[model samples]
Target: MTRDTPHLWTEQKLDARYENLFGRAAGYLPENRAALDAWLDDFSRDVHERRARNAIVRHPSVADLARLIERDRIVRMYVSRMINEAHQRDCKNTVNDIPDLLDHLDCIVTSTPKYQGPTAFPMSALFTYLMMTTDGYAVFRDQGFNKALLGILREWCAHLDSKDSQEVLNQKNGWLSPAALADKKLNLQDFQINLQDPYGGFPSFNAFFHRELRKDKDVRPIDDPDDPRIIVSANDGKVVRIRRDIKRSDEFWAKGQRYSLYDMLDGSDLTDLFVGGDVFQSFLSGGDYHRWHAPVSGVVRSARVVEALMFTELEHTSGRDAGTESQVYGASVNTRGLVFIECPPPIGMVCVMPLGMTEISSVTLTVQPGDQVTKGQEMGYFSYGGSSMCLLFQKGAIEKFFPKDNTGDMEEGDPIKVNARIAQAVGDEA
Candidate 1:
């Protein structure tokens, strides 16, 4: 799709789509409602409730939201309203209330995401309905609240990493199902799967989510691997934006969601090297390949995962595609993995950043400092969540971008294949 074309369905369409999906589970059962009521009562009367209450009030944004809304409601209240709205819309199998929401979230943590088009962002969808509002948006921006949220998500990630999460690998309504493979356009032949083993020998949902790509030259061959000048895409995704003369710090929260180098790199010591450099950002859909690859042959200099907020999105752009448009903003604020590679001269240093969006916050890195990496070599992968990637180049490092495009222009939603030539180094003529 072109940049001008909206990537999300309208509210009516979104509602209809989710409604149909939920219909299969039957509307929230009576037992679920009873459990929800009981939990709510216990949650309200618990002596430890103040701890949960403080998780909101201590955060600046949540405090601001409470004042503006003229009430100091707890997190449970906010989540309950959010889930109730979805329940009221007749979206089946949804949480009956806040307690039910926790249980639903637990289920998601242990199971892999089902194949559903763009509407696969169920958590984001529920948050979108609530967070698009003035109060909800402010509350989500609170660091304390997000910290608590991240703790919960980390636990979920642990569960996803365990063997129990592999139960969803069945051919029926699972990731390997015919319907899912067709929907994702994933060919098992392109990957390294154990044909003899059930569930393709994957140990967990996370394993299946970041399945290894075959090393055959033709499968995802490096584009001119010997040519250091030919920079390739680090991951399989759609180009979101390409910006030059990036600032050290900018109005990242503004409408454009401009790149803030210092913030994006997590204040790394090497941030200054790319002050006026260029950044190539892209968005990875739930169904897209999740592995990271070297954009240029180089030696890994530094690599680390930076912890940050999990669910915050640009308030103005919430609800549509569940903050897919907020990628640039996410790069600055979300949890991400950063890998700095020092390539041959002229190409200099390149930084590959994988930013986690919403529920997809696990950034697993396979390489470490001092390791030599070749172009298209696997560096890491993101486990089961919406994700985006950014490649940062040093000032004047790149002579041109979108190597095949004569105009050297890229829109927000342009598809970019992994290992495909994306840019050219400044000194390389070929």
Candidate 2:
């Protein structure tokens, strides 16, 4: 049926996209298409009835279907999940949707079909899962999102202690050293020495205050499980934010832009590791795809053959401070042949990397020198998601990260919102 068009979305693509997503989501449903259809028909009628019955409930309406369906309990369960996932890709403001979604949860839950074996995802549980995925801080901006997110944290996490980080924060029981501090969004000052941080010998009151640590982490100095954030926002100091292409070596930082992409990573195409990036978070592992897949699929072209590499690592190795959006994509290396994730047509390669609490701490990749890879295969695992992957383009390849209407370039250290085009990959061959 008719769908709402986002400022960035095209009217023409909505039908096709929704249909395509429905098809893919349908895979998670039963093989019996008839049963699925029947469940949907009843689900829509139920939602309509609820609107008539009560106005305070929040649920998803199964209306606007291209075709009718008469689904079973199992079918209804899957449909609820599918609807929730579709909205996560692009949220909609249906005042009635939430209550309706929550209402059906009880009706469809039961120990029916199992995913692998014993662990079953029932309707109510799946509804909760979908709710968690979509109920992120919405309708907010930079600070608002931060405040709202932090509130959610307070609701779900424990209270933090100090935020004034002068030295390297101690690793807590299960929290990063620096996190919430970055969220304070405060400016830094000069002449203030944090006698704690041990960076390069040079010290000039690090312009970007708290650049070393963030306040978003759990500030469990001793062992406070109730700490909401690793680092507290109210008590933390400032951090320094360096742009992409940051280099410890003077030569590289001064003249990195001069050299072409090939020279940056120091390798060639023919290799086994095709893709590599900072392991901010993962869906397969821990919502990794949610952080990377959108930008990857948006502008990547079909002409170039591509492989996928997911790097898993601990948060401390990347030196990522809290409050700063974690990077999930970075400079991917290719030591062997020029085999890499090709640049999406016209939109070079869009990288979605969220480097966590560690940017540097001596980490190693569990991958060999050369290995072939598929688009979504794993290459190696790092301690944290702190590495980088480069979007490779052969000698005569085109690089694209931005769409014409939108300019979402992957310029070193920029946050990528969903549906934002990062780059484009288009060359002579493209």
Candidate 3:
């Protein structure tokens, strides 16, 4: 990932950003310096109590941030103010305060996410509020800060991949529990789960997360798998948007969040091929299938992961879903895996880009360069977290997008099954 100096924020810009975030909220304003100071005193005492009882060991990034805040009075005030603001906004049913946020982070190290509405991504919920602050805008964009944060996420991923993480596969408050299954809309019979083993014999949470579907045509049948001209959905997700006549570069961070081919492809040699092409974007929720598949039958030309920011979102967006709503912006900046497959003529080369958001930044690719892939073949999967995918087609490559026109009874934000036909090539007769 390229690193740049953090942008300097003037007082006017800072206040404007604050107003953009909290201007409509009806409560005590977090901008009050004295109120923030008092809240920090109470928060400090809470942190001390948590440490005394739980013997908490902070994530390295958190510890480093604490040290940094301790040395700088202005930054410390900003941190305290942001935390106070987050506590007030997120006090409904989730992590209500800083200590609770820290406790949830500790819990995530040992346990998997239980299916809760907004709290399914507790870290995101907290950060969504914090990221609206001026300090968060600068700190999250800093190279060194993001590096430390990525390190912490890697460690968490390691734990989730270990066998010890499978302890959460039980019936009581576990991922396999009835409540969780119902909430996630997961059907064990639809997947290749072991009916004999109590926990389906899965070794880890990551294993269960990307569980393979049973090879039943009715479940996820590929639409004309033998036809190279037909493109299928690469993953199970909701169609977010589709854009045509894309530019090489655009103001991706702007309110409309236009697609920028060069930045999205990470300056790849093939980036120019899609300059005036089309992009199909979709989103995967915490409950959706995490594995990615081939959108066309072809030879894999390039497959590699690109390093980028994990938690940063468009600063102008609001709501708990700000990070997710910034998918177009994320396509240019978030940690993602790009796979280029050279198909037959007319269809040309198709680029499948899987983007990671917030805690779901671990993208593991299973296919390598020069490998021949059939349509619907598994290529990679996101370990654990909210994710989205993008399929790029060269100029004039797509004749029609099925989902865009509500073909096959699909509409925007509707659940799309993997391997389902999503689009047709320019030369296709159908």
Q: What TM-score goes with each of the models?
A: 0.75, 0.23, 0.79
Instruction: Give the per-residue lDDT digits (tens) of candidate 1, residues 211-315.
Output: 888756377777887777899999887776778999999988876547899899988999999999998887676556889899988899999999887676564
Candidate 3, poorest ten consecutive residues by summed lDDT: 20-29
Per-residue lDDT tens digits of candidate 3, residues 265-285?
999999999989999988776
Arrange candidates by lDDT, highest first: which order? 3, 1, 2
Candidate 2 residue lDDT tens string, 54-140? 733321222211011132343334344445554544533221343354444322221122212111212312222232222221111
Which clashing pairs does model 3 show?
none
How many pairs collide in each candidate, listed in order? 1, 124, 0
TM-score of model 2 vs. true structure = 0.23
Ranked by TM-score from best down, the candidates are: 3, 1, 2
* Cα misplacement distance, residue 20 of candidate 3 (Å): 14
Q: In lDDT terms, which candidate is top?
A: 3
**lDDT against true structure, model 1:** 0.66
**1 against 3, candidate with superior lDDT:** 3
Least well predicted 10-residue stretch by lDDT in candidate 2: 228-237
Write down the worst ten-residue block by lDDT for model 1.
22-31
- Tell me how candidate 2 scores on lDDT: 0.25
